[model samples]
Target: MEAHSASYLRWIVVLLLVSSCIEATSFSKVKHKNAYATMMYVGTPRDYEFYIAVRVLIKSLSALNVEADLVVIASIDVPHRWTQALEQEDGAKVVRVENLDNPYKHQNNFDRRFKLSLNKLYAWSLVDYDRVVMLDADNLFLQKTDELFQCGQFCAVFINPCVFHTGLFVLQPSMEVFKEMVHELENGKENPDGADQGFISGYFPDLLDKPMFHPAPNGTKLNGSYRLPLGYQMDASYYYLKLRWSIPCGPNSVITFPGAPWLKPWYWWSWPVLPLGLHWHEQRRQTLGYFAEMAVMLIQSAIYLGIIAMTRLVRPSLSKLCYRQSDKSINLVHNSLKLVALWCIVAAYVIPFFIIPYTVHPLLGWSLYLLGAFALCSIVINTFLLPMLPVLVLWLGIVGTLMVMAFPWYPDGVVRALAVFGYAFCYAPILWASMVKITAGLQLSLEREAFLPRLGEPWPPSSFKLY
Candidate 1:
């Protein structure tokens, strides 16, 4: 029996080995085919806008008859809600990179985040692909881009006339090349300035190449070589037109930045009336209108409460300490009072700061009339739903206010007041606390004996601590 079992086991092992070899051979062929396949990479914090961009890309690619894969590398904390949305899209794969360590881990800084994202992209070089293209989450595809595959070399990029926009680019993935790039970036070998574009450009100085630029129709400055015509990548703003409209184009034409298009300097004149020359401007406008409506609703609620109180429609009831009834009643009353207080504060202070200026800015002959119109539209739409808008807006508003206060761009006293009251109030406390902690920690460490040196030393060890 033992001899028979041993023979059977040997045969099973042999069969398993043969299966493994067959699988390996199959995988190699697949890799070879995929080598020529075009792929686009988009990284985001996993939000609705990201999914929207993915859907648009998938549809555009399908129309172009291009065989492509959509790769999304997201952090672990990305919500599962995005998973379902991405999975539902054809030719899309969402990859969650676990235990990923960001070399640049400075949180809350935009520059640091951008550097970390580039590093993450470099890390993705290990992923199976012949060529890779990186696109921002806010972008919308206009047409089929199968031609991008033909341009593959060491690296292919879309050049903007104004700046080197890293929002989109095509490159072959090489682990060795990526590692060298990372080492150069981290060690400040090639780019001491720490700019990712400078490092990439310097590394492949000899390999930079551009394709032909497709010219646009006359009277439409939107379609010229400046519009990412061919090897050239233009700012999405170049398509900006009267009343916020933009020209439509696809896989070849993409919307780089979507969420805050109104905040862009060029769009300031057109303001809220986003040009509809593009495909998704209506959706973008709807999103903006949604947020604006939220603010207006919040203001309306406050008005409702104030009027109710003035008419004595709802009386404030007092409750004394008790075992069960008072406990429940007091809790309810406390919550109610808190809600009323918050609503009043938001209505009186927060909403007015944005709304009053927005309303009067146009009528009072302030230069940005389009901005006022946009703000008004937003407020009117959101008047009933402001209370449900995400609380992040408050946090964002505070941070924005603080930046203005710290910088003090306005010369006039009124502008200064607006800056202080609007921006400073939200950000000053947290900023002050962070500064205090850093200073105190440094002082404490400096005063410590461990940080000092023994006698007869060339210099106190603490002296080097300043570095």
Candidate 2:
């Protein structure tokens, strides 16, 4: 009887362990509150940029005093410093999750930008919230959109008329659905675009036929899937036409940047051209101030100023050479040296543009680039006595290209590309003309001097060895 009782207890223990393992595999709904959710993961080139954007987003939501919890579905690899800032500084709740394996990553045409985007499917496992509005970090909130909680089990906007945008959507968390979705992923579900957008769209292919959602007057939660109005997820492109928003429906709440990745509102250069980008910057200023990048900018500015000063103070002279007037070998060497000097000037302008921080405010970034370029170009000018017109023309050309690309009236990206191409075509001849004039001036200066010191001129006391 003792042995039989011991055996029974062992079997019971085994059953308990199996039950716990099963429970751990699927989420169980517990909390009753609603939440505003967004996901963050690493491995993207724009990780820091997105990190800043997410913080600004959460802070803006808090500033609006929304009635729902701000939740970030952060991957486990996201730095503790970032997650801590979101939790403590920004008053956001972070749910750490593993990077969701993207089964479609091996397929051709898959965008690497969306490599970790499938991590968004973890929203369904967030059973602590009765409803969650999954958001993209690029969303700029114009007003509180707490009413999104009233949306049903699945709801999204049809920004493209037929297809609903996944940038922002409402969903009710369900463990069974989450489990089934994982099962589908494991079974190699058809994800045409190889991202969450395609997978979710495929999962709910019938949402386009659903009725428009109208929340009941008494705040009763919606049950079935429905379509959200365009006002909730207004595309940022719409405001470019008139530079004003006129979306008629629910409160014009959130504006999403569904255009080019570089034109996202968080990018400082995206403003003044996109106008709406300023709104995002304003939100950032009100919440996550620019103090962090300011120090780096100040340091860079001082370094550039020092370089300019040193280059001006020490007028480093080149070695004086003797040459016959009709020597073809000397003439070839002279032409080669002139070409090298011109290339150096071009490099001076370009190298600094890439060296400056990528996401600094546009004004600061452009200012630093210009100053650094000028400093570098001054070195070439002072050393080789080359004319500055060629360098100035190149700088002006860069500014022109930016303006043409940022012009808001282009009907589509293809037209924008063509406009840029046309601008380049028009500018090339002028640039060539400047280069020719610069080379001519340089040649004239060299021939007139004939590499000979002026009468009674003393040799420099210090010289760099160039062996």
State which candidate has the highest TM-score.
2
Stretches off by above 4 angstroms in model 1 are 1-65, 89-91, 98-115, 119-127, 154-163, 189-199, 206-232, 241-252, 258-273, 276-278, 281-467
Model 2 has an lDDT value of 0.80
lDDT of 2 by residue, 11-71 (tens): 4453344334324422433233888989999998899999999999999998998888788
Predicted candidate 2, C-alpha RMSD: 7.4
Candidate 2 off by > 4 Å: 1-32, 317-328, 396-432, 445-467
Mind giving the per-residue lDDT tens digits that candidate 1 earns over 1-467? 89658645654453344334334434533322222221223353323434444444544444555555555554445566655555464444554433223333443433442443443344225346655566654445555554443334343344444334555655565656654654454444544334445555566554424434332334121211122343234344544422222334322354555235333212222222233222443333332223423465456445545543442332211111112233346446434544543354345334434433221111121222222333432332122112222222444444454345335245544555565676556666755554355334433432343433233334322221110
Backbone clashes for every candidate come to: 25, 0
RMSD of each: 19.9, 7.4
lDDT by candidate, in order shown: 0.40, 0.80
- Which residue window of length 10 is worst by lDDT in model 1? 315-324
